[model samples]
Target: MSLGAFFLICAMPLLSGCAGFGGNEAPPPRPIVTAPPIAVQPPPAAQQPTGVARDPSKFFTPAQMAGRPLIRVAILLPFNSPRADIRSLSNALYNAAQLALFEFNNPDILLMPKATGSAMLAQKAAQDAIREGADLILGPLFAEEVGAIAPIAHASNVPVVAFSSDTKVAGNGVYLLSFPPDEDVNRIVDFAVLRSMTKFAALYPQDDYGNRVRASFEKAVADHGSQIVTSASYPPNTEGMNLPVQRVASYGGRHGALLAKRSELKKAGDAAGLKAIENSDTLGDLGYQAIFVPEGGTRLRALAPLLPYYDVDPRKVKFLGTGLWDDPSLAREPALEGGWFPAPPPEAHAQFVERYRRVYGAEPPRIASLAYDGVSLAVALSAHAEGERFTTEALTHPDGFAGVDGIFRFLPDGRTERGLAVLEMHPTGAIVIDPAPVSFGVPPAL
Candidate 1:
């Protein structure tokens, strides 16, 4: 089948009336239909069958299953987490998964929600799901919880599409569906290199996320035959950012050069040179064409202005970032006005957000798409013959699967590679400078 046809087939079952398929021609407009919200309720206690095993059928009514062959998909989340924020996120994820289930209209698939408020609980939940004959498993949002369930899922040969971004717990039957930092780094660096940016610098936080982005950034620059002129890491706080930003900006060296230039101009008694140096605090370029600021939110706002303050002119030096810069508020930061970042194509995500709002009456968190895609993928794959469905070969298909986030495929190592677009920050909004590729191996139009 053609890529477009394959995507239309896989995506039609999940999307509302095939709304967001990729092609040159726009899909015809359809009447807006508000789907009934899936109820968010506590799962009833599981009833054990005649022997030691638990009956997964007990989790659903006969009418919902409708006498079809069962495909139990266990979704483990921290529904009872001590933290309110975690609880809310868990609920949202579950709701998204439920939305996918209804939209796909798959009667054979039974979604099982299990609480994983702690690592111990997560392990037990995995045990229960396996014992209950879960054909596939979906979540357990944190890395620690994923670790707790990986061995159990591997032992049972049950494939898990998890939501955690940590690659440490991914592999051997556990695949992460969440966005990885490497994707953002690779996409942005590839676009920057294509745009003739060779010399690079970075200012990243001195934490796990920073370390991951730094490693990816270095590898990407080297892979593209570019060089890192300078980089610095600092604590992710307002107070700890100044020194690192200044260091990356090369303030001391440039300031010393400015002083030397002023002295030379005075000795020569050149009025034009003196006047040119008068308003500038630093002299000479930072020797980098682009600088990576892989930060977001308050930290980004705090860290951005420091570059211009230390004479790293944004006009001359392009500011690059990861997906963290997807925030619209970042447009207000003059330092990021011309910055470039990689993110999922916004048009599809915007449509998804609108549908989610219409159904659930609130804005879904950005990561909520992970759950929707995971369930949609499962439903799409379930159409395969019994033995072939949910296997490594089927799940790792090179063509990948179309998702709300974009086209993504599972790597053998259990990491997901997604098609991302290069977006430029503008005062009005972020605009796509380069579109995301619709299929693997085909490059996006520049």
Candidate 2:
């Protein structure tokens, strides 16, 4: 498909069905020219259906008025969920969206913040939105929640920009405004290849998240004309990481080689050579030149030091990681001091954080920036479109958008493509070694 067409995946064939919720109990969304409003919860999850989408106007049916017409944008999230941790993240995102709306100060749009306590609630909320005459939809944070909202929104022909990262829930008229690991790995691998680090390896965790990361990493490596010399997985815990580390270092094979070298030196009675061999570490070259650790936070902190201890020293093998490495606390970890990872340019996000803190009176979560970007994109599109906005063509603009992170746009496959940078972990802090792309571009495929 063409680049522009590739972005409007919803325009192609209709293949999606999303569930939803509706109720007067939802937080009423006010207009931005009057912006409206966080909360926390935990994580757990996980599906969806397929069908042709219906015309949006058939259900939206908002009557035309003077000046800029007021459009209703639904903001579905689990504001009152059971998990406080998840609630915090979702609330931060909601606040970020509110911040964007406040900044936009666009009197033309009325944002509706609906508390989607569950899939059933989300489904009802969406159905209620259809009845209320919504022109657009902003989110339903979780994948299943997005599914609940989809069928109602699509059948009504209303366009949705869901915050869920699960690509499986994307399709029909729904667009995912999430940073999936697939894009993260693809961008990092591209950066790795550009650094001339061809040989690759991955130390993965034994979990579904790790599975996705592994698949993305493999495809990215292959696409860049590189190969994974070693790939191994370990349990989620800190202990027993040895097997994966040893496999990557080729510990058994190298030990055998070391013994053979020692035998040769001993047989020849070369005292100086024997001494040098004894003092030197294991075989320096383990084939792969770079190793990717698809982990982050304390788990990553625990896993990184093991590489060198297991003989895969930074001096020999370059350590790589995903965007998960973009954490302030990580700078304190000496083991990750020389590692590299992919993320959006930090300076832009720093500006966002400062503004968010000032407005919200507290620091927002890292992922919350996405909500700001998503809402900002909505505002940008709806500002002067005269209701023509939110269409596939308008939503999938080729220029993409300049958000808190960087440039990003939608794809025909119902996925988001973001321009990311290659960051280097240092003792001081993580710095952008490579800036995100200034323009939109497709990621290379395997």
Candidate 3:
């Protein structure tokens, strides 16, 4: 199975670091969203960066290193895996990091190749990266690998910036860099609530990814004081899809009997009756103005029509989805029309895109830029601090950093507070019909 498909079945358990924050009641009072300063744009082309400015903490702060010493960064990835896509993604991320380093006087970042397609190989690679004197460890990519390496990294006190979102496996110095599935639902729920979507219905896969998304969506809905009229889970397959779609779409308390009613229709009348029944089973009403779908785009395409089938007009009901909905195929899917989700919109990184293409001979993928930002930001912190300890003070500085992606600053919990744009998949194969209001400040300190 593809890594994306497999991630659905086996996901790493998340470790919650509540930081003694209060109960899940209302999220603490949020700062007003305002227009970011125009300087939020990319760095000026003419402004010659001092080496210290390249990574401020690395030089400026008493705790971080200065002058771009050979930053021995070790990239840990599942390179030997059968899934070439993830391998390619890893390569892209590595290339992006390298490019970032080159801009900062080309530090001595190394890729510690591992034979991690199998369980045994992953262990060997994890040990090897540490042995090689890695200052900052990039990844072991998968959740299982992260779990295996967490203790080792903790023991070594080598800061690991990971690609996996499974926070449970992330050790003290390990910072998860992958977009959390819960954050996806949170953004959608927040947007829907802003637009006044009071009732919600969800149909998701019967797996961990789906479960994580469902839990987040449920919590968001409840937190917003909205009701979830119907929520169901189905196996991530075609046959498993139609039933739930029919159930959630069915009108007037006749959710489970669509198939039975179809059987009762005479052969001559069945064709016409099936059409009518399908239509009846598909449409939702005014009260159900939002649908949260956490499944991947392929399955959602098949299920999308069922939204209209139940009477939920795609135009009327605000469709919410996960970060996986960023797939380009979503544009071609008729059911995804009017859908919105939170993601690092590529348009925001125009300069990064051009530069990456110039360097890598291809457009940078989502995670590639993210990994680049992680390394670049780390270097920035290292430069700013002018020491090797990498204190928390170095990380949360508000000098307003810029990278291949847009401006972002670090939060206390090691999560990046980035400005995410809410993009819509238009019928014309375009996205980002309406952008969310950008928050200029650091995201509530995590």
Candidate 4:
């Protein structure tokens, strides 16, 4: 099938079923199309523009406004960010949004791309978008940028569906669509608790992400009637990890106890006690039944093995993680095998990745799905009556919208609650052990 036709078929369910929501009820599940394989070559470097091009003509064409009522949705991003990585992310987000628009075939929705490389620039972008009669704003992908534009968008009463994971900027008409660590922590902890794991520990980094996850982890454990027996904080990098890992394992105390026991056995002439202590490095049970490791990538690799190395045996104490542990490569780490983490269901996301690769000829960043879903949401809501398309009430429907990442809905406070699945790490890859719910209303507890 043609690529355009495939997307059109995939988009029908969302466009038709997402129009109306009465009262505070869950919406019916919308069917999603799984695209077949398509052959396409990769795009060249020139196709990925690094420099900012604010030309209005690039996004808005005369043919798009063929007498239909327009819904201006402005997307503010760091198109000219000094950091090349940020700039590339901005381009990917823009491309994803454009792809969503094209797939849904929403001609009346004019996507206005604005550069927000700095707070001042983001404020100006917000002003320009509001001046251009934008009904809704999509992003300014940083916390500072979101803060800069919040008042302007609020004054204009243009609702913003931003992409920042920081919950601090997620209120007063600014909804965050990005994946917050709280959701991951809550889901995994809930799953652990359901499986009868009571006491827990954590090994986290000393950074903003770590702090956020730590807070969520504590609350989740407490709410599930479980206790946090111990936790250790380490530097964000590989350095300074040994002390913290050892601390969590109580290595010094446990080893000291082992030596003391061995000496006592020798003095008392108890051969069995001596034999038990002869080979054992530690002599005490861990206080916790499970340990939460919220680090990922290199830091995760460095941190995970230390637990087992320090005698916090994975067989005795479960290893838990947040969405940061969603990497398939982490499965190769022996310490992470049988470890569990929470993430969005992979079925629809796999299809999204395939489609994106076919079209863009590159792997879309993990967060790129946010832009596609944000645009899909705007398109779905555009089918509503004029002046009611982007209201807070309309946006916060209890029955959330289904997207490539699965089911998600915005709260009145602007925080997004997502349906996450629990996955176990195996030598081959991560496998979904618990499926994500198709609809909302399920409590986090068993």
Candidate 5:
């Protein structure tokens, strides 16, 4: 079997271009009915991509087609890597994309799969796809790999739909389909701003991921006309969490005030009044009304109990978070209960999980759905203008595309904004405080 330089290539070549694609057709009037905001149920398995080879009249209308090329797609992934550890992840992603294309089952579209093991190898594979005349490309999972192949794809005027979660490597003809931390931070913090939270503080870990979350938190807070009053970072561990937690809670001032007030009452010899307040921790209010803890999983559990011990009570200071707080395990910690954050609607993903488990015979990672959504979106776009499907104009559709993680769209700048719901932590799990909207036609009311 001939590989498309990247993957198994079809012997057939398409003759369609995006030029005559409905150019002369009149634009339809704006629809009175809106598309569903988010699709919880996956698209039916029998669905097909649009523009399956007909009499060429569909895209060209007989007059325009004259002779154009059909759309060709190249899928790039680290299928054979030196690192054996990530083989499962890469295969899962590849399988998801394959599923999307399989479900599409469009005869008009031509596909190529490119496998790369390193940055240099990815560049070689990408060049092969371009040589094969691929109109669109999908994936190269890591940031460095995306960085390596993006220029090659761009040189060929082909847009890449990459699955890298890192947003820094995005843009210039590459679209990252992975969930970036900015989306989670922006959604949750905006919800906080909507709820009238003014002052924010953070107890973040001293690491790259923590820094990214903190940066996103800061930007979100500033954009909302709020401010971060304090931020403290600690090395990852239970060993040194006390210092950072104390600094974030402002233990010195709070405890100092308590001691001073207690001294004042003692000097006056009002033993009864002193007794009434001696057992209390609060003597002065914390500067921030909300504290954003971006920690997740076991690390979050370690940090949570430290807050109340430092005289910082969640009862007073609202606990805020990103998707990191979505873990059901966090609910076991009483301090995390009632904490608020943003995440995709769970019901939609629940359906996907069941479906995927049935097919794969194992539970797929959450990110596997991202791969499916990316390929599925490409199929949807191919219906309109196959060759020009990856245009900036087409990709940044304001209404966005509904995927396994609800609805998301690419911004003109290439940042992805997802329609997310605010969830509150309960002993049972993270429950939706506000349901995600059906469409982002209107921004959520502040």
Candidate 6:
């Protein structure tokens, strides 16, 4: 099996493929959009302080937009790779940009190509478009491809809005429009702290996705004054019962890795060994009351039952996860009775699904939502960023625009301020348990 499969197998339990929700709630006739919206709650308070006030003049002064030339914008995505769902991705990006453009009625905005199918092709395409007087570029979706072109675009001073979740590679003019699971992990820890669930124990796969989320969760927890009592990482792929069983025996001890005291590092070998097992629990032991899992929907279902085997009662412990667990399968899993995961409102997703089906016959894929949001956001910027200079003043206007994802605005630092809702998973299905909007504080003074 592949490394991804290997890691996932070790970290999660075996389960059948997810079946649709088992409820009388008909999949709410597909929305005109790909997914329907969750029942709308009262909109959260607007104008809440972003915690950081930005000096808008630094990025976009009034003098910038004046008399700038109109420039074309290029959007490139792999629409031909053998393994990729090119048509769906391309259509979602195209449709989203088109939808936003239609509302703005701007003639300067131009969509570059139908789509590029490979990284090499996308790089060449972007270069060609830039030479052809394209002012700004949008997309080149995959992370590896984005890394390949970001430097090229940065050198040319052309901004790109890429649908890549790897924040480590994003820089100067390249804004990531994709949502990283790491960000969700940070948000989950923040919410966990607010609820006074401090001691955390993590069991995550040792891979890029899992490691990224683990780091963010640890950072957030520490910042919030909570402690990570124990954190045990499993190899990316594990099979049979031996792996988890052994991991439990090795890492769940009173003097396990997590319980080792940092202050005792200078001691002799005897002290170090002793510290490693301090405050640790026995095998199949759960040392913390809260567990933050960063996993895909399928993996989450597999890991659910193991919590109890490790002496962690799912009902008693607060389980936190990301939008990855937004699927109905999570709610239906008996072992995931009290899990809480963050997700965009269901009604909103339903509506988008309906719209996508109406436009293209089938449901929009999950990743397609990011493509849609990315292009729509870029189109919003293009509508007003006329002439030669893409004015920061226009992009960060006091009155921000709403997009398919949510109400949002662009920060001068190239980060986006998004409004997201948290969903709670029940045995039957998920409900929008928390109505509060997570505010990405405003851009810091730059």
Indicate which candidate wins on TM-score.
1
TM-score of 3: 0.72
Top-lDDT structure, candidate number: 1
> Comparing candidate 4 with candidate 5, which one achieves the higher TM-score?
4
Model 3: per-residue Cα lDDT over 46-128, one tens digit each: 22111111232331211233343544566676666678897677667667766656544424333233335444455555555
Q: Which sections of candidate 4 miss by over 4 Å?
A: 1-66, 265-279, 442-446
Error of 1 at 47 (Å): 20
Off by over 4 Å in 3: 1-68, 107-115, 118-120, 251-286, 385-389, 396-402, 407-417, 433-446
- Model 1's alpha-carbon lDDT is 0.82
Off by over 4 Å in 1: 1-7, 12-66, 267-269, 442-446
Q: How accurate is candidate 5 locally (lDDT)?
A: 0.72
**Candidate 5 residue runs with Cα over 4 Å from true position:** 1-72, 79-85, 104-113, 263-271, 278-282, 442-446
TM-score of 2: 0.82
User: In order, what lDDT does every prediction score?
Assistant: 0.82, 0.74, 0.60, 0.80, 0.72, 0.58
Q: Write the per-residue lDDT of candidate 2 for residues 213-255, one digit (tens) a residue.
A: 9988888888888899888999977777878888877888877
Q: What's model 3's lDDT at 84?
A: 83
Those runs of model 6 whose alpha carbons end farther than 4 Å from true positions after fitting are: 1-71, 84-108, 114-118, 236-242, 245-285, 392-401, 436-446
TM-score of each candidate structure, all chains considered together: 0.87, 0.82, 0.72, 0.84, 0.77, 0.69
Clash count in backbone of candidate 3:
35
